[model samples]
Target: MTLFTDIGALVASAIGGMQADGILPGGLDLGPVTVEPPRDAGHGDMATNAAMVLAKPAGKKPRDIAEALAPRLAADPRVASAEVAGPGFINLRLETSVWQEVPRAVIAAGTGYGRSTMGGGRKVNVEYVSANPTGPLHVGHTRGAVFGDALASLLDFAGWDVTREYYINDGGAQVDVLARSVYLRYLEAHGQEVEFADGTYPGEYLIAVGEALKAEVGDAYMGKPEAEWLEAVRSFATDAMMELIREDLKLLGVRMDHFFSEKSLYGTGRIESAIDTLKSKDLIYRGTLEPPKGKTPEDWEPREQTLFRSTAHGDDVDRPIMKSDGAWTYFAPDIAYHWDKVSRGYDALIDVFGADHGGYVKRMKAAVSALSDGRVPLDIKLCQLVKLYKDGEPFKMSKRAGTFVTLRDVVDEVGPDVTRFVMLTRKNDAPLDFDFGKVLEQSKENPVFYVQYAHARVHSVLRKARDAGLDVSDTALAGADVAQLDHEAELAVAKKLAEWPRLVEIAAKGHEPHRVAFFLYDLASDFHALWNRGNDQPELRFLQEDQPATSAAKIALARAVSVVISAGLGILGVAPVEEMR
Candidate 1:
């Protein structure tokens, strides 16, 4: 049902036919030939580089290939004409009937209109929003959470068996600090004042956890030393922080399928087992790394340690798995975590990390590669910072989060829908400026409002058609005379609808969901442009009060636009409002 893919298949068949007819050599690779929308709309509905890409390999001039391929493509009933453009590019102008079928198809399919089976049910593991359980999510984690969740949804729409996951860094020294901090709060909860010195969390959020601890165990080990209550309070505090994190995620509508804990690898021998697997591949060795560049050689000393040969798998340097003191470094558990994911039989793995973790990307990839032996591909996406603004100035931090704005603060300011939509307006690696005042503004400058307004307009048209005693149901709209939608304004909206399936596949393959947001904005712009034209031209209006047949056809087009916008918003994990208040 993907028109672009169907046309691509037809083009491939024509190439094979030419080869069978002795016009071109058999078994030539046709993978590079692409049938896509032309860069210039004046070119045609679709353009192909088949002739230009195949000419050199097929031992013929590009113009000759184009001249021969043009008639072959035109033979299809859908192609009204196929013309050779400059430099052997062939542009195909499809029949108007072909474009008209798009809305009917959309009405028939509903929200499933743009869904594609491009992934073929491949299992994909998406690990995102894996901030340490030390505190509630911040603005940095907010961006990663939105990006990773949207990306997973986009892949799911493209037919992948997607697994959404979160990795909890509950085993690190940070948790120890958290335990001590909670202990201080626990002491304070027992009617004793405690000081939060350096290396301890000072956020007021821990106050409730501390009180809960006091309730759970009253006067038990209240005067004990660090060794007596450290482990118990650490476990208790990590659980509390994770609960807070989950609530923060829920506020933004992010739900993870699984939460893997780094602590799980500690006593389970998983870390040792993963390191042993790499050792078998000769990827592990005892080596002394040279001092980091730009550091004084006299101030730095190299010591032997267990290291992973990460350079063999594209890392710039070998990474240490164990420290000089024979303790496992932070990288050891990470390797085990990825190894566990690899052993789960996922076809692909993706990690969404904050941009500050940029240095860890290559080493993590190397570990996964070594463990999986190149059987699975790992993609690491780093989300850059988000700058929050209000009234053209940056918003202040939350006192509860100590130094940064909490995810809850952002969500509470603007509801979840606005927060999610605004978060995805920019690419993951690009810094995003989220203006609280600007996002809520019901202007075209705000894409969330613009897209939502277009959807609401479609519903308004459908309502008008229904009030005029015309059937605007999907079943009736599917049978409407969309062929009568021949006006340039009507066809322009249909053409935009036609790009949905193609856009889904493109976004899924590139692992970028921001493309869906961009496509929705363009589609919304086209719909609004058409709607504005109706003010001057009565024929372009969707609601023809006196003519039921004409109104049904026009309503079918409007309903199709909503169907696409809803589907795109669904992929972005944003709700499509039926009406704007």
Candidate 2:
């Protein structure tokens, strides 16, 4: 279905035929051989490094192998010419019929044009946005949520059975602080004056939670001690906060398949079982870690503790899993969580964390490796910060969320489509500047607007063709004599469409969804270029007066571009607009 992949198979077959004729040695590795578009358009349509990769193995000169390979490739009906470039690379220019078939293939496949079976139905669990269930999600968590959600969708499109998961950090002491904070609000609901100390949360958002709690209990805990009501209040507060987090994620179109609670790992011997699995492999030991390099804390002391021999599996040093006082460290629960994921029979695991969690990467990787017996691969992606700007000044914090800008703030100001598209304009590891004024501007500098505008223009062309008594449906366009679309400008857009399948496989294999956004922008640029060129050359216009055949051919190419843009936007969780407002 992919033009580049088909051509690559043809090149491989030609080389295989060369081996059969005894022109070259047999059994040479062809894994390094690749067929892709030439970087310079003038060189040729496609280029391959077959000769360069096989020359050393066959004990022959690269140019000599290229010379023999060119003739065999040129013999194919689809290839127009095959020329040996510098060194050993062979550039191929396919027949016009080959490029013309691209639009027809796109029309047949519709939005499913780029979906691939590369994953072979393997299971992958992507865990992201595991922020503490203490408050509403902030901008930092928003980036992780968007990246993880898109990655899961991309993997699914590549034929992977992906599970989107979120780990709730509800077992930590922070939930206790939330309980105390809610207690203050609960007291305030009964006409009692209270002052929030430095340690308690003072956000006005929690006032509603307090009011709700008062409605439920009816002053049952008004005269109770902290010990009597702490557990119940903590449970209520975490549930409320998670509901808030879910609503915030709904605003940005992020949905998780599973929500695992850290508290569930406790009192269930899950942590003990996970550590036992590691102990059976001799990865668990009792040792004292050397003092860290930076500065020592006032309570820092070296003590023999239950440790994980993480260095055995590629970590920088051994990590402690249990404290000297018989309490599990923070790392224990994380190992247990990953062990739970490994037990579920996932072939791959991905963790999307904020940039500040860089230290957890190696240790977590080591734990998965030891637990999975080197079977399941783990990839951790760290999303950098998103800096907000408005009118050339830094955006202020949200008064509702107390300390940071909530995800709802961004999605509410600029609709969900804009928020999701703009978030992925940059790679996850790179810092992104979200300018309120610039993203809303209807210009080429704003990628979301430019891409949306290109899709809208395609619809305008369809409307104009319909009014002119031309059948512009996809079926009608697919059967048109597309050979009329031989202009370089028109063919350029088809060539870009042909890259969709290859691009999807590449992005899915790398576990990077930002590449989808980048590809869409380039495709939009090519489409816009073709549109602008039509303005100056009346013959290049999509609809011609009294020329239904020519107009249908041109309209087919325009519809193909829109189809690809829609598919790419779906991978990024963005909705393509038919009309830009």
Candidate 3:
């Protein structure tokens, strides 16, 4: 019910009918044309660029084609009239009943109103928030975590089979650092003095890991060499950090389907296998890359290394698969990880990365392309940083390994519902300023509160109507006298309801969940505006004395608004607050 199907289908069918009737040229593709809302609401309900797109191809004036197409489009029962406006745009107005039945359709569909089959049930793999297992997730990871989780929900709502995954960076030097840090804490737990080095993590989060090591084996590794305890501590610390991460995700309402490990890829020869695949295609060879564009490292020297011909697959330069010392480079495991995703038979792969990782996008895409032979499409989304603001002042927190503001810090500040919804207020690539004061404000600018308030108001009206001896339950509301919904303002709300389905498809196609947040704000605003109109015009109100029939129709419209709000909030991982506290 998000989009009125009949009107769009009729208009498209009319174009086909014109071709059959020979009024317009046959064999011309009319699909590139689109029907969308005009910039000015006064222009019309929907506008199409049909004539303008076909003007050059059809060799007819834009105005002439619009003039000829207008009458045929208007002949349909739903179309009240069609106007050829500026640049030969075809503006359309549907009949009153066409807009009026939108509410009834919404009640019939319930929460499924805006659900779309755009993804065709294809499998999509989304990987995000793959922060190192060295410590708890920070605020930067929070943005990506929320964005990825919501995007997966959005794709699922749009009919994609999605798998949410987190990649643990346990195989890197960072994990070794994590082990050393935990060892220092473990010694302190045993009443031994230890000094943290410049590279070591210093935070209270590792205290639990320190105690856990003590509990597992007392005085067994007190004086052991680094090698004797390094592996054990790395294994123990990684598990502890991952548990902390899982709890943080739980607080934010994000449930990952899989937690992949870089450690597993290391010992399983996955990196070697992926490199072999590249070698078979001659994409891998021993070579030396040029020094990084502007700055050269102090240790920079020309040495032969195993390189992946990423340039052949669209990267700016070739990427090394192995270092000069014949050890796998960091990019090697990443290539294998993506190769694993491609081998899983996913139709699409989406990776959410921090903005700093923009340079890795091309090489990652090239790897997926080379591995999948360009069959599987990979989309990389880079989420810009989220600046924290509290009490109208700059808010800064730790970003070091273990001392940072964990994901729990955020979810604890604002509840998960507010945390999730407020994070999506901006596009992923755009910077987000999360002001503590503004987000919780009871005003229109506070989208989280405004949208939630709209839902609460609907419930309030429902409660009032139920006590008035009217059956206001969803079943009763669905069977109400919807035909009585003839007022312009009432039907206007219904019109917004009809656009839900169409919006879902558009959002899913673009991999943008922020569009849902924007649409919800617009829908809530419309509902609120209509509610305000009732104060001046008594007949527009939801409750009418001695008129249960009209009351049912109006309440049905109001309830439909709440139903949409609930569904949208569910997608954003926010619980629809029945009562605004």
Which window of 10 residues has the lowest lDDT sum in candidate 3? 396-405
Candidate 3 per-residue C-alpha lDDT over 1-581 given as tens digits, one digit per residue, 9 for 90 to 100: 54445566766787788778876787777777888777887888888888898888888899988998899898888789899997799999888877777777788888887888888999999999999987788888999999999999999999999999999989999999999999998999999989999699898788888989999988788999999999988999999999999988988889999999988898787888988999899899878888876756765777777789999999999988877677888999999999999989999999999999999999999999999999999999999988888867887655434556667777777778888898899999999998877877899989999899999999999889889888988788888878889887887788788888887778888999998999999999999998899899999999999999999989999999998888888888888977877
lDDT tens digits, residue span 95-155, model 1: 9999999999998998999898888999999999999998999988999999999999999
Give the C-alpha lDDT of model 2.
Answer: 0.92
Indicate which candidate wins on TM-score: 1
Q: How far does residue 235 in candidate 3 sit from its true spot (Å)?
A: 0.6
lDDT of 1: 0.92
Give per-candidate clash totals.
Answer: 0, 0, 5
For residue 369, give model 1's deviation from the true position in Å: 1.3
Each candidate: RMSD: 1.1, 1.6, 2.0
* lDDT to native, each model: 0.92, 0.92, 0.87
Give one digit per residue, the lDDT tens place, for model 2 in 467-580: 888898998988989999999888889999999999999999998899999889889999999889989998899998888999989999999999989998898898988887
How does model 2 score by TM-score?
A: 0.97
Candidate topping lDDT:
2
